[model samples]
Each structure stands twice: as C-alpha cells, then as structure tokens.
Target: MSEAVKEAVAEPALVAIMEQLPKTEVPARSPLAHHTEVLSRPTHENPGVRLWENALRTHLALRGDAGSADFARGVEAATGLALPERLQCHQSGEWALSWVAPDEWLLTGPGDQALAMEMSLREELDGHYAVINLSGGQTMLRLSGPKARLVLMKSCPYDVHDRHFPVGKVVTTVLAKSQATIRRVGEEDWELVVRRSFADYVWRWLVDASQEYRLSLGHPE
Candidate 1:
C-alpha cells in the first residue's frame, strides 16, 4: 500500500452525533415546564436548599482509556478541562468534566455548544474512543444552600457527609426513588444529572423533602 493510502485508511469516518437546537425562536420546554408556577415562587429567607433545573445544557458521555496519556491530552486539548479521576469532577469556565467509571467520563457545556465541542473532540482523539452526545436524554438540577447536604442525606442511602462526599466528588446513586449522577460542585452546592422522564418526580421529591427547612426555586447557575 502507498503511504498516502495508508494515511487515508488510518483516519476513521466521523461518527459522533450532535443534537441541534431549533434555529427559530421557539420557546423551549424543559422537563419541569409544567411546574413553572412552583419554580417561579420567590425564595424564602435563609432557605435550607435552593432548587433549579440546569436544563438544556449539553451532556456528552465520553468513553476511552483513562490510562492512556494520549487520551488524557486529547480530551484536555479539546475541552479545556482535564478528565477527572475516579469519582471526581473538574470544571473550567462553562465546561465541566466528571468521571463516571474507570474508562468513562461525562463532559458538559452550554447547550448550544454541543456540536462544536464534539467536533473538536473528534479532531483531537484517535483509536478506540467514543464520544456520545447525551444532551437530550438528561437534565441537571442544582441543589444548594445551608441545608443542601441534609436534603441529600434524606434522599440518598449513600453517605453524603462532607468528610466522605467532599467537594469535587461525583457519584451515580439513588435520589429518592429514582437514580441520579450526583456531584458536589461547591461547599454547599450539589448537582443531579437525571433522565428527562424522571426530572419531574425527582423535583417533586426534593420539594417535599426540603419543605421542613423551606424550599425555593432559583435560576440555574
């Protein structure tokens, strides 16, 4: 085989799929659209936990060899954020990367930037790696305030104590009756990545659980 042919054969056809938002000015309906009345309510004084849907953000499930130096370098080169270690998350600007498993990570960014980010990743990465756009399948919810940890403890069986959970940690665990990929984003803030179908149920459950300490809705950060 000629050198030119070998180079052509080595390059794989791009297979990454990106979900595009509507080009027109149509109003987007989130999973919690019907609950706007509840979410529109004003925040209570010193509420225990503040709730909001981080809806429509881009979510990408990245599968590759974490042990490979090339893989790590390519991901950072593409996303401007490092692939996190086991059960950890790293955020830079509008992008966040969370480790889901030994060889899997979740990359999230602005909803409109999904396609561009995926293309960048495809350009930088090679070999047995996969980049899947999961933006449509999932939505994120932010839970934060003074009593956020207490609310999480009430919902999940996992030990969410600061000593164990800590900042920058992520976990795939139970949230009330449904499952969620949970991450601690700050000393008092946590994020829940849940399926669109389960978003309403999870939101309702959190509202009920947080009532004792007072619950209020806020815009996603």
Candidate 2:
C-alpha cells in the first residue's frame, strides 16, 4: 500500500476507537432532584451527620493493564493524577482516580470536562485500553460530619474504621442492600458513587439510618 493510503486507513481506525459524547441541549439532572425540599431543610446546629449530592460530575470507567508502564504514564499524563494502587485513591484538585478492580479504575472530575478529558485520554493512550463514560448512569453523594462513620457502619459490612479504611482508600461494597463505590476522603468525609436506579433508595436509607444521629442536609460543595 502507498504511504498516504496506509496513513489514511490507520487514522480512521484510531479515531473510530473512541466514542465521542453527543452534543445536546438537555440539562443535566441529579438523581436526587426530587428531594430538593428535604435537601434544603435547615441543618441542626449540632447535627451529627450531613449529606449532599455531588451531582452530575463526570464519571469514567477505565480498563487497562495496570502492569504496563506505558499505560500508567499515559493515564498520569492525561489525568494529572496517578493510577491509584489496589483499594486506594489519588486526587488532584477536582480530579480523582480510584482503583476499582485488578484491571479497572474509575476517574471522576468536573461535570463539564468529560468530553475534553476523554479526548485527552484517547490521544495519549495507545494499544489495549478502554474509557467508558458512566456519568449519566451514576451520581455521587458526599456524606460527612461527626457521625458519618457511624452511618457507614450501619450501612455496610466493610470495616470502615479509620485504621482499616483510612483516608484515600476506596472500596466497592454492599451499602444499604445496594452497591456503592465508597471512598474515604477525610476523617469525617466520604464519597459514595451509586447508580441512578438505586440513588433514591440509598439516599432515603441513609436519611432514615442517620435519624438517630441527627441527620442534616449539607451544603453542596
């Protein structure tokens, strides 16, 4: 094949590997939009537990060979954050990369940056890898306050004690009968990524379970 023809054929294949985000005018909605009233309720002066929806943030499921140095460097180059170790999380400013499994990781950032971020990853990465957008199908909730750990204790069987699940640790576990990718962000702060279908059930379950500890709606950050 001629050099020009060979280049033309390979270029399309490279570009075709990525699925671009559709441009649309539809407004993004949070899974908990119907709970505006409850979320807007006044918080107690001494509330022990607080909850808020992270809402509409970009979620990308990444799969590749973790052992490959090229893949790791490409990810770090595109994301500005290193691929996290097993059950760990690495964050930089608003971006976070969390280890989900042996070959899978989750990358989340500002809602509006999905397309640009995906493009960057596609451009930098080569060979066998995948980046699938999961934003529209899932939402994140931020749970914090003095009793946040207690609320998690009641919701999941995972050992969330500080010593075991310290800051920057991530785990996928059973939460209130639903599954959640839970990340410990701080001493009292946690981030839970849950599917849209189970968001309502999980939110209400947390609210009810937190009643004893004085649950309150936290201001969205």
Candidate 3:
C-alpha cells in the first residue's frame, strides 16, 4: 500500500461538538437591553424610519465546498434550504441561509435551536467543513420604513439602490465604522447582522442618522 494512503488511514480528523447555550435556563439579554427607554419611546405619526431587534437568534457560520454535490445535498438535508448562490439568501420558514463568501454561509434560526441545528449539520455533512455557533457573539436588527433606503445610503458606501441591491441580496459591507452583513428583505425593509460589541454603536449611529426622518422604535414581531 502507498505510504500516503497508509498515513491517511492511521490519522483521522477530530471534531468536537458542544452545546453553546447553558443547560439550565438563564435570563437572556440582547445588546440593547439597557436602552429600553430609548427603544420604547414614541415617535412622530407616520414615522419614516422604524427600527427593532431580531435579538438572540441562533447564528451558525457554515463553510464548505459549494461546487460539491455532496456539500450541497448535505446542506439541504441539514438546513432544509438550498445553498444560496453568491450574494443571495434563501429562507425556509423561520430559517434563513445567506451566502457570506465564496465558501461560507450564515444560517440563522430560533435562538434555542442552535445546538440542535449544529448537530444536524455535523451529522449530515462529510469531508472538510466547519459549523460555528455565533449566537452569543452577534445579533440582528431590523430597519424598515419609507426612509430606510436613505438611512442605508448614509451608512454604507455600497450602492443600495433598488436596481443594485434587489430583495434577497446579501452583502457584508461597512456600516458606520463597523461591518455588517446587510440583507434586503423587502422593498424598504432591511436586516443588519452586527457583532454584539458593535450592536450599540450601529444602533446609535442609525438613530442619529434617522433623526430627520422621524424614527420610531417598533416591537419585534
């Protein structure tokens, strides 16, 4: 037998999987929990910019060979959604899988299901791949209203025009001074996934930028 083949048989990769969330119930708080007053206040009638938090949802960073049939099938088997093409996003029920890079995607679902989802992916996937639970390190925010596009224009250097950034398009770009995975969900609705540490900075930046547009804080649905 070839030495290369012998070496491959002698050594195997080790993968460690663990539950990222606490086993016991614990009070969960979002990055903006301390800004309750600011988020709960009223705004002008027919406010032009409405904001809210998706908060604490499970975020999984998935990496695999998009060109492989096994990779694609395994992802669909584990996620129940197709692998999104470049700069695209696919949603099935409460789960959304978005393409973040050539070989990377972001999968988000109910907050409590991070471990289950991660396990399922590990079970179905083979070969070199990675699934990381980022639920505790980042959060999602929703921004919608007539002036939402304008707000995005002020924040991101990327052209957010309707033609350039159609619905279901995902782009990781600069937001204020931090970076955000921005997705266009609807005509005027957008979702921003930011790091937990930068959540406050992004929120405050949006608030100040939307001042002239009459900002309103909406309850998450």
Candidate 4:
C-alpha cells in the first residue's frame, strides 16, 4: 500500500450534526405558556418586582479547559464575548457567557442563531472540548424592580445583597424548592435560568413572594 493512501485513510472524517429550528409556521410555546393569561395582565403602578420568561432563547452548555489559550481565544472568536470568571457573567450584544464551574460555562444567544454559534465554536475549538445544546431543557426568567433582592432572599439562603451578589455575577443556588442559575444583570435586575420542569413552580413561587411589594408581569428585556 502507498504511504499517500495510508495517510489519507488515517485522517478521521469530520462529522457535523446541526440542530435545526422547526420549519413549520406553527408557533413555539414556552414552558410557561399555560400562564400566559396571567403574564399578559396589565402591570400595577409601583410594582416591586416585574417578572417575565425570556423564552425561546438558545442555551449551550460548554465544557472545556479554561486555562488553555486556544479555548479562550476560540470562544471569544465565536461569540465575541470573553469567557466569564468564577461566578461571573459577560455579555456582548445578544449573547451572554456565564461560568458554571471550573471547566464549564454556559453560552446563551438568540434562538435562531444557536446552530450557527455552535458550528463556529466547534470549528474554532481544538482538542478536548464539548458543546451541548441545552435550549430545549431549560428556560430563563427575568426578575426586576425595587424589591427584586428581597424576593431572592426569601427564596434562597444565599445573601443577595449587592455587596455579595454584585452585578455581572452568576450563581447556581437553590431557588425556592428548585435550583436556578441566577445572574445579576443590573443593580435591580436578575436573570434566572431554571429547568423546564421546575420553571412553573419557580415562577409561581416568585410571583407569590413579590405580592407583598406588588408583583407584575412584563415582557422580558
């Protein structure tokens, strides 16, 4: 056998598996679709907490070596956002990257761009790295307003004070009876990423917790 033929046969074939969005015009339903009626209600004056589901967004669970320069550069090249530090989040344009653990990060962006983003990352990253599509398994909710911290305090044991959970920080903690990856996007605004199964429960729990200060539902920002 010729050396040229052996070399060509030794190279592994690249396999690309792309996830496609539904092609039909059928409307996509959110995990909290059943509560649409309540969410569509008018906001009350001086509401303390404004809540809404940031539905249908792309969520990718990324696992890679953060210490590798190639990994960092490749991710930034693909998403245009730096990989966040421990318990932190970095946002650029429509995308956000949150640190989930020492070697894992979460990447989120517009729903329609998930496939493209994943493909880009796969192409840029080399060696041992993984990118898993988590868009279908989780849902994101936004909580904001004056008493948003109070609502968080009521639900989790984590000290949500600005000094502790400052803006741009992300923490995976217990939220009510479930777990959520909470990100402090602003001084008064928070974003919670929860499993689809626990989304309804978490939403109701938060709404009830905000009742003392007046709760209202609004479109996600």
Candidate 5:
C-alpha cells in the first residue's frame, strides 16, 4: 500500500458505535387512556410508556462541528434527511428534521429506522464527527390537539403563537423544571424532547397542568 493509504488506514474511526444494550421490558399495566400522563411517569407512581407505547419514531444526539459544510452535507446525503435551518424543521411526507443545536439535530422517523438510521449516518459521515444512538437517553412525547397550545403554554415560555412559531419551528426552551427541545409537528400536534431521567417530572407536571383543560393523553399505538 502507498504511504498515504497506510497513514489513512492507520487512523482510528472518528465516531464510535456505542454498543446496543439489551432492551428493558417494562411490565404491562392497566390501559388508562385518560392518563395521557403515562408519557411522563417515572415508573413507580405511574409507569413509563416504553417504546411499545407509540408508533412514532425518534433518534438521539448527532454531534459534529457545526461550522463544517461537509459534515452538514454528509448528514443530508446519508439519510436523505437535511439539517433544519435555524429553529425550524424540514418535513417531507412523514419524516422530519429538527435542529437541536448548532452542531446537532434530531431525526424523527419510523421506530424501525431508529437504529438503522444511526448506522447509515455513521457510514455516510466523514472526518471528525459523532452519531451516537441516544434513543435510550431521552424520551419523546406527543401532546397534540386543539388545546395543545394552551396546554403547552402552561409550562413553556416560547411564543407558541402561529405568527411567532409557525408550523415548522423547533426550539430548546424551558419546560416545567427541566429543559426541552420543542417542535411543532402540526397545528394541533407538538413534539417534546425530554430526558429519560426527568420523564416522571414532565409527566406529572403536564398531567396536573392540563387537568383543567380536560386534555386527553394518548399514544395512538
């Protein structure tokens, strides 16, 4: 092999494939459709609605140099997904991209694609970058309906008005006692990005706050 080729091959890969730990099987409980609160439960007072709860899909942190054009393009080329511009989302049919930060974005796709998508990103990306499948580190919940805005306003401070937050806006804003990357999926459908550790707090806060509105919590699974 040429010296240049040897040098290239000698360097270790930039992103590591974080091992896939065995999935936890949450015990099934009584079906309470009204307790839309399951999404936030911490697994004792109420139970966490695991991956089996919803048909929706999600991927975790994609970290890279935000200033690298090649990194941005690599993501687009890798997943047929593009990084959202600023605090907005890019949706084509069912899939959407939400900017989580200057160097990261969240990919929402089918549940089955969660792992495969991360692999594709790993293979497609070049240079120094990282794509760790953090699906386990956080949970995504859908709080949507005619009253979704009113319900969200109870905790979030972002201007949820259609004029300020159009249908495609995404933001990292304060949520209850924690923080969230909130995105608008539709007029009535909103997505919340919350840490797994704080799931209980988020669920209880939402349930108590939305009780006055008769909000319905659901997974539609």
Candidate 6:
C-alpha cells in the first residue's frame, strides 16, 4: 500500500531535532565511524538496551482486537501494507509492518511523517484499540561487521548462528539487563534496538562483555 507525508513543519522543526542529538558520536577512530571505528555511546548510561539519546525517527505501538472483521479491514485500508500474518511483516514502499504480538504491531517511520501516519491509522480502526505515538520513547543502533553476530550471541540466549537466523530475520528477545528487537540488517550487520530508559545499562553491559574479545575498536580516537 501507499501513504504520503504531510510535510508540515515550521522553521524551528530542525532546531528541535538538533537539540535532541546525543552529545557523543563515534569518533573517527571508533569502529562505527567512517574509518576503522566502533560504535559510540550516548552521554548517559541506559538501562535495558542501547538507546540513541535523540530519537531520529518515529514509532507507533498499535493494539486492536484484530479478531474482528472491522478491525482488520480498517487496518488494511489505512496502510498499504497488510498486517503481518501470524508474526510476519508486510512492506509496501516506504512503510513496514512488524508483528509485535497476536494483538499488536509497531508502525514506524520518519519523525515528521508520524502525524499523518497516525491519522491514517486512527481512521481505519475502532473498538478497544490503542495507537500510542512513541516518537521519543526509543532509539536505534545499526550494528554490523564480521563480529556483530558473535557479539549478539554472547549477549542473549536467542541463537545467532546463520543456520538459525537468516537474513530478513527479526525477533524481540532478551539481552543482558534488558530486552530488544534484534534484527539482521544484512549479512554482517545487525540492529540492537533498545528502549529509551534502558539505553545506559545496555551500553555498559555490552562494553564489559566485549572487552574479552578485545573490542577496543569502538574506543574514541
């Protein structure tokens, strides 16, 4: 399906985004930087998972009594993408459909387009349902490299072997001190998505665990 961005923003819109960016960035020497750098940390220590202090995108958590015909129809009409069929995802152009549960899903996109997306979703569904705009409640970490999968195996119980988790895999599972939606972005990269409150705790935990592997590549130049 297809949806359009409303493109409604005042001059100060960019200023707000700038103010929210995390003070620290992975330096040139860090593995995550342009060179042989590593991932950087936010200014503070988070709790459950790694959190980007300034959320660069928007997220919506939706819950509907989807067993009903009306709820399903409304949702399908609202987003070009169909609701995931039994924990599966459907993508139509710019949108993605992620199965959060039997009754819920997370609709996500650029921050500026959130309002338009919400309006479209609200128009389609009724009955005991909820759509909370979570633009500021979480963050993203795009993890990659030859050793990214190994790092995840050490952090969580979910199996990380290629035989078990192939490309296009997404699962919400546990990490040390927190839980996250670990997705395989590519053959070498993975994303360790964490919540806003738990960003610090997860960062520290990752660093400590990675130390044994000589993960000094992430240190600042």
For each candidate, what is the lDDT?
Answer: 0.89, 0.90, 0.92, 0.90, 0.69, 0.62
Candidate 4 lDDT, 1-221, residue by residue in tens:
99999998889766666674766888878899889888667777778888999989999999999899999999999889888889989998889999999999999889988888999998888888998998988999999999999999999988899888889999999988899999999988999999999999999999899989888896743
CA lDDT for candidate 1? 0.89
Give the best candidate by TM-score: 3
lDDT of 5 by residue, 128-190 (tens): 877767566666777765666887777888789889988889999999889988888778778
Candidate 3 Cα errors over 4 Å, as ranges: 1-12, 23-25
* Per-residue error (Å), model 1, residue 10: 8.6
RMSD (Å) of each candidate, 1 decimal? 3.5, 3.7, 2.5, 3.4, 6.8, 11.5
Off by over 4 Å in 5: 1-10, 14-56
TM-scores of all models?
A: 0.90, 0.90, 0.92, 0.91, 0.76, 0.66
Candidate 2 lDDT by residue in tens digits, 1-221: 99999888788454433333355786557889989877666777888998889888999999999999999999999999888899999999999999999999999999888988988998899999999989889999999999999999999999999889999999999998899999999999999999999999999999999999988896644
Residue 27 displacement (Å), model 2: 2.1
lDDT of 2 at 109: 94
Per the 3 Å backbone cut-off, how many clashing residue pairs does candidate 5 have?
2
* Model 6 Cα shift for residue 210 (angstroms): 4.7
Worst 10 residues of 3 by lDDT: 14-23
Ranking of predictions according to lDDT? 3, 2, 4, 1, 5, 6
Alpha carbon RMSD to native, model 6: 11.5
Cα distance off (Å), candidate 3, residue 107: 0.4
Question: What TM-score does candidate 5 get on C-alpha atoms?
Answer: 0.76
lDDT of 4 at 71: 93
TM-score of 3: 0.92
